[model samples]
Target: MGTGANCVQSPYHVTGSTWQTTSTHFRKQHTPHSLMFVCFSVGWVQGSTDFGVGFNLALDYGLASVYLENGTTVDIAKVEGGQVYKAAMRLNDNNIGMINGRTTYSRSEQINFKQSFLDNYIYSPNRLGGDGNGNNARSRALSLMLKALKTATESYLDSKISNAEVVVPFPASESYLHDLRQAVASVSLHMPMSAQPPTGIIAARAHGMYGKCFDDLDLQGHDKSMKNDPEQLILTIDYSRAALTALLVDEECGVFENRRVIHDTRLGLNGLHQLGSITATDLLETALRNITQLPLDDGNGAGLKYISNLVIIGESAGDPRLHDTLRRVLSEQLEPVTTVKSGFSPPIDPVFAASRGVAWDCWDRMNFQVNE
Candidate 1:
């Protein structure tokens, strides 16, 4: 690691992290940059847009993000339907439309949700550690959070959340997954756990950002190409509050197949409020180096050398400094000829990038099942 940054400067002094800025000044993303003003019922917001990613993570209640029916992501703070930095986001299940707004649920204004499904979903953005509660009995805090979400959701919908899907960290131990499942079941809730990487893949699929599945395309994105070009190698970097995860994924048709994983538990955006104390460059450089060095599964397809597409998510991924550092690392560590692909324009806010993707998958399955 680069021994830590001596003095970190504000992002205002730096240029835009990439040609495609994920949002406005990346620095502001450190806090709950969004507090949507829409109806949200039975949603959870922990450190970052919660896949509710991890356990007992501290949360900034100032801004909360949720994904609506049309794949729109918004944060609502200090208002009805959604509250920020003060309490969990809550919306009247029946009165989900036009909460505290002049526009009542006119026929055209209301979203056409599946009769059995809720219309809105919560997406935790960034940061996941210390939930204002101390670190002891961490899992207990997570269980309570889920339990509360369950109660609030059921109370409003007058219907059970038949399916509560959660995105856990990639490569979670079997025991941890079991404990999580037990906790959800203990609260009379059913949660299906998915590894973190799939959440990103689903998000990418929803946006069609990586191109249609199972076809020959250029080295990057979904845009059509004439030549039988090499498959796109998308490197997904999730810089979250508790950890930094790099997933090397190959396009398997339209879906993503995880080829490798690199994790850095020591270096995260929220190193326990020690963002300024640590040197992000050193840790980032180390992580990126490891990613490039990992071997493919016995040369199944193109190696890391062909990683032409980059999809960076997580609250920290929005940092201008981190973005700058990432560019620097890619240029210095990778082959001189390698050109890291920048420019990500997803359909929804990065905050709900993963959550929206998860919902899209669920929505498709539900539609299929309901139709059947």
Candidate 2:
């Protein structure tokens, strides 16, 4: 079971007949589960005035059990209404005030909750060797889970089976899978290994939870552009021109300091300005860096040499200003890095030439790394 923020609690009605008596009687008969409890606190501060509110919530799932009798076993999983219960405790004086001709609002909020369930029923044989409390708890939990799984399996099989194999599936991160394998091995050595080897199921899921985010961006589209025109330089710029424009208007007029107006236009202008200058430069530099450091390799370093000089490159090929900067830099600094082939045959796509020229010009303007 895991503990987190969202927890359910019982509802209360203030204007009800004999509500207090009913609440008391209900509490007496129902034993609350400590695991499924939540506490929340809220507070607000304005100037010197402070106000606060707090509450506790609890949830309970009905119990289930397995019993062995007459050489037979029975197991059941039953849950209650799962109705949430809540109680509020308040200590505050509500008040509002302004400070420094501006409004200041502050509030504090907190919630803590834990789950009440023994969800896992399998234990790994491997254990970390350490006296640390964390490690001990983990080892103990694993043992319990394994024991539970064994019992469940024996009950399910309905045979006089003293040992049965169980397989645990884990995602395919190499490091994690290795660790799990070791843990299982350790467990097997401690306990009798099943006559037949237990299966280890590796999930086919990809690494990195955010892999979908990259896929959603559709970066593959850029790959085609890269192949069509290797060395296609790209640059992106955001001037925050809109924000600057708004600020300019504000400065000219008396409404320059208006909070609402400033807040609305400030973000747009700031973003634009950043995109035009810093963002543009960043894109150019990234492309250049990638070009110089191509042929990336995996842990084995097997394919590095094969693709080392197959020059297919691109950068943030977007803005003309940024492209020009890159061009100047290349002409000055990169000229000495490699011998330029004279009378070279151009690629079918002429755009690559324009891309190279732009990058070279940009590089030259800044004297290529001298001012970098």
Give the root-mean-square deviation of each candidate in angstroms.
19.2, 30.6
Deviation of model 1 at 1, angstroms: 54
Tens digits of per-residue lDDT, candidate 2, 250-333, equal 011100111100111122222334556777455545434333332323224432221101111111123355346445544433
The TM-score between candidate 1 and the true structure equals 0.54
Off by over 4 Å in 1: 1-139, 151-160, 191-198, 211-229, 272-279, 294-304, 332-347
Give the per-residue lDDT digits (tens) of candidate 1, residues 298-319: 2455444455556665555577
The TM-scores of all predictions, comma-separated, are: 0.54, 0.18
Error at 285, model 2, angstroms: 24
Best by lDDT: 1
Compared with the true structure, model 2 gives a TM-score of 0.18
